[model samples]
Target: MNQEIQEYNESQTTDIKDVCNRLAQIIDGNLPEAESKIWHRHPVWFLDGNPTVGYSIQKPGVRLMFWSGADFEENGLNVVGKKFKDASIFFQHVSEIHQEDLVRWLNKSKIIQWDYKNIVKRKGELVRLKKS
Candidate 1:
């Protein structure tokens, strides 16, 4: 566990922390290669040194974002921001988490490489490569 992650988790509300915890468990248990770290103030799960998924505490709720999520199935993803091929799903309560749906995405996420820089510079490059 990361110190930053520990601090962030401790500072959040119980519901928010619970959502974070569940997602962390899903990623950690399913993806042995993925490492949890604090990136841009959020807890991010990295695979092959690239950010695959991350969660942040926002004003509306806890936002779970996938770095190359634009390529992921529409099962539970919501396209977010016009800049990059990023997608997100928001959970207002802990009970809203669908473990199966999230785990499916997590499995798919590891196969895609997220170049945080190129994602902003050349949108969809990662997803395009993943599809090819």
Candidate 2:
């Protein structure tokens, strides 16, 4: 872990960090033996140099950004955050993350890594097609 991740992880409230850590562990568990790296100023889990997932700190929150969030059709994982118009899921607080949902999203991302164009299109479509 980088200093930033360590600092951010430590700075989190026990409840918040607990959730964040759990999320990380879930991602790691699912992608066992994969190499995880710290990049984009955050903790990023990768496989064979391809980004599988990313995480970052936010005001009063943390975000679990998936590389293929747009390809996720179930559980509304694509619309989990205000900035997710790209390909990320932001958890405003630890309480907002459902373990099952996060795991599903991670698995979804892993499965859809090669469908980048479709993923981007879906993300854009969701933002433009959905009504607030």
Query: What do the candidate models score in CA lDDT, each in turn?
Result: 0.78, 0.63
Clashing residue pairs in candidate 2 (N, C-alpha, C atoms within 3 angstroms): none
What would the TM-score be for candidate 1 when compared with the true structure? 0.83
Please state the error at residue 121 of candidate 2 in Å.
Answer: 21
Global Cα lDDT for candidate 2: 0.63
The residue-by-residue lDDT of candidate 1 on 23-117, one tens digit each, is 77777788877778898778997775678788998888998998888877575799966767789999988799998898888877876555764
Best TM-score goes to which candidate?
Answer: 1
Count of backbone collisions in candidate 1: 0
Alpha carbon RMSD to native, model 1: 2.8
- Which residue pairs overlap in candidate 1's backbone? none
lDDT at residue 62 of model 1 (Cα atoms): 91
